[model samples]
Target: MVSSVNNPAIAMAEKPPSLEKEPMADVEVGIAVTDEKDDRPGEGFGEVSDLKRGLKQRHIQMIALAGTIGTGLFLSSGKAIARGGPVGTVIAYTVVGLLVSTIVFAIAELSALVPLSGGIIRPAEYFFDPALGFAQGWNTTYATAMLLPSEMVACAVIIRYWTEQVNNAVWITILGFLLLVSNMFFVGVYGELEFICAILKILLVVGSVIMGIVVDLGGGPKGHRLGFQYWKNPGPFVQYLGISGSWGQFLGFWRVMGSAVYSFSNVENISVAAAETENPRRNIPKAAKRVFVRVLLFYITSMFVVSLVVASNDPGLSKSAGDASASPFVLAASSSGIHVVPSIINAVVLTSAWSAGNSAMLGGSRVLYGLAREGHAPKIFTRTSRFGIPYVAVLSIGLFMVLGYMTLEDSASTVFDWFQDLVSAATYVHWIIIAIVYLRFYYGCKKQNISRDELPWKSPFQPYATWVALVSFTILLLTGGYTVFLHGEWDAETFVSNYFNIPLIFALYFGYKVFRKTKMVSLEEMPIRRFIEIYQDNPEPPEEPKKGWRKLNILW
Candidate 1:
């Protein structure tokens, strides 16, 4: 495989290198790093204009944290519990965590092998079939796009917790627009804002976890020792959903496990964020290795702390576990028998949701830009605003945010439920693809006889771990359609969740293929290196933070 941006737009006085040629007779076409010169007008078989490397290590770290813990975890964990029972949910999350770590390790290895603007997608073309790589990349892009709206919807829901006046739908719409404006400006500013937001999210997660641990350890929410009776009496397993204390008689515990999976989905986004980091070789692997441990610490540990103090069925908890304001952290604090921690938690949820949403938009736009650079999509996506932001793609993805807000026009929670179902189902498709792509790439590497040592970071267990993640992810995607199987209230969950993904993805993939005459590229014929080299925009490590904001009183 060769570097893709061997020819940058700037300082190329020498004649351009030849690109791959196409055949008129053959129905199948492939993209490879050859020199035949098809020289198609819109689809230039030339080097992409090399982009700047402005992102620092701190940005990558914060994005790694913020990206992994979305509102899905904060809000939907209750739903997962409702579906999978405590025991089932526990096993599912742990399993998902294990699988996610493996796929990301595979990804980290690939990123180290070929770090490009295209990131993981770059390996697909080199290692697997080019068509597979393109399809996987595009689908992942849509999945990322879905996140922006979901996060904004989360933002609106958080805001509604504070007021009864404004319609929640209206608030979502407003917030989406504001977020769009922020992202459309410049990448650096967006990075800076996101950095601050990430810090706030970390503080909230750390503070709330510490407080909950203290409260549960006999310090008392109200000077009364809760003493972990929930664990003993509820018996760790719940035994029964409504059977008072038995763990077996549950209605929807599996459903709860489903929610837990979503919480962990953002964990993989860290690899995507690594693509844009300044010193990827140094940072992407570091971030990927730490992300898994950090997720275990932040998510499992914090939830463990919450379960100690608050019962799964705590009434003080928001009736809508899907709402950020109703997060276990805040509700448990409200029951804290303590002071203003509940209110503070609610405030934290608001910022956390915002940061998650921003990260989604940021990733989606970057992916879209990468698409254009590969000559697979239109050129407009390549255009960046003065702020070095992909203004057009950002606007396009942010438009989805309105989908979440439009539901707010109704007082009934029906719209929110439907939106959640759609996003949840769509999200599964994305995860499934991520796993499949990585696993396929692993096998493809074998077919080509690539060595593990050549990979920057190696996945511990080769085929077994990748298959485990793929199977488990596929299970979640299939089970996501359970609502469709119900005899009554089919309309409640809506057809969107059950049937939308296949068509949406096919339309985008095949439609572009026919329009651009793109076809399957052979593994050897794939453009492995020419386009990938530009991804190594920065091959060095970034500097550490110079300022200490916590020390100042009026710093901001």
Candidate 2:
């Protein structure tokens, strides 16, 4: 018997052990029927997780802010402009941003209620099916494992801007070591580091936007008041692939969708560490509700500013330097005769790369730990140190950081790029899975006669928002490599990278089902009411009123 002090749900005397043990059974369909008469708090959907809750509300907010602002925004937004013109780029970002907002809300609702690790994966098992949970869990872990080396390689590339005398392998080694060490500490340490990096990134983006506006108004030494001149000349859209008229413009706009998705890849990471968060029911929702604002200020507005100062036709935007030279902000400043901008942008982008790697390490390890807890992964990954750090999982994921050395070789570097593309496609599939799981959670609540208001927190724009995101992301996934299908444009790498993950996910799902015979969790058996009882029994303390300086710290 479990103590009520540790878990209030176990205090219910009338509850049967079968209700608690069934969902975790491996061989047969586990049906967890809630006892309507026994209103006492029930044990949460699963076993009591052991991960420590060291992340505060501020840490949650900062992680959400910093996680998504990485190389995609700092370096690849330029590629978006070159592929799609200013108008097209902005539109694609806005559309994807809105859709991504829905995803954030969907996950937030589930995370607030479940408050578990593994982002949507844990909830996927409870609300959808164990097979889906197994599939997406591994998919996320694989993508995040690949992400570490990719970001480390980007760091090595950025360092070359300062001095190529040092071997790329040296920088890769240094960055990988720092990331591994950082994730091995307590969760607070990682949160504090990300908090500081997020502030720096926010400052750089705000400063760049202000600088862009000044340059557009002829405030720079160039003295050319460039008010929307690029828009007029490039004519709002590019004629992609030498095609003419609206069709070409449409293709260009469609192409930007992938880049936009990549730019916003990890925005939903706010809840990935839900079990390690303080007052998660409140903080996760707080961080999630602000996603649209962050998307507008950091992404859409910055892309709009880039459009004003940098022309879509600028050759610099197409440069393959893979450093600050390829950033549109750097291009704008250089064109305006501001020489110091390259070093400044390079410096911040380097930190962004490192920060991204650190985030990947944390997210990957936690997902692996969650898999272990669910019996999907080896039990060794479940080991944790005295600090409540999953050191074994962290070490396992850190081993992949060695992949950064692949960049030292020419042919291996090309292979690394293919892996990066595969990760990008996998990101879309992850979002699609989130939507599916949330929809199931939504209908499960309805099927069991649970009210949205009864949840710990409810996200606005319910079933409609999720439905739209589902259809749109599905279309984007199918057409991700459409160019390869066109005449005279058959690149095996692009075709494979874009479409390979589809079959791979299906195989994982079916393989797990065939081996384990796990069935789709029926709505009636979902532990929604049990989870609600836990939420009601264990109430988090109300936030204290802010006074003076504390009130001013609203950035979180």
lDDT against the true structure, per candidate, is: 0.58, 0.82
lDDT of 1 by residue, 28-113 (tens): 21222223333211112122122334556667667666665656656555545444434545655666666677767767777665
Give Cα distance to truth, residue 507, candidate 1, Å.
Answer: 5.7
Give each model's clash number.
39, 1
lDDT of each residue in 1-556, candidate 2, tens digit only? 3232222122221243343422332111111222222322222333223567788888899888766787788888997899899999999999999999999999999999878778888788777777788899998888887788888887887888899798888888988888877888789999988998998899899999999999999999989899999999977899987789999899989988888888888889898888788888899999989899999989999999999999999998877677899999999999999999899999999998899888888889988888887678898998888888889999999999888776653343244335546766998899999999999889989998889999989999899999999999999999998888888989999999889889989999999878876667667666677667667655677888888888888677
User: RMSD of candidate 2 to the true fold?
Assistant: 5.2
As a whole number from 0 to 100, the lDDT of residue 63 in candidate 1 is 67
Clashing pairs for model 2 are 9-42
TM-scores, one per candidate: 0.79, 0.92
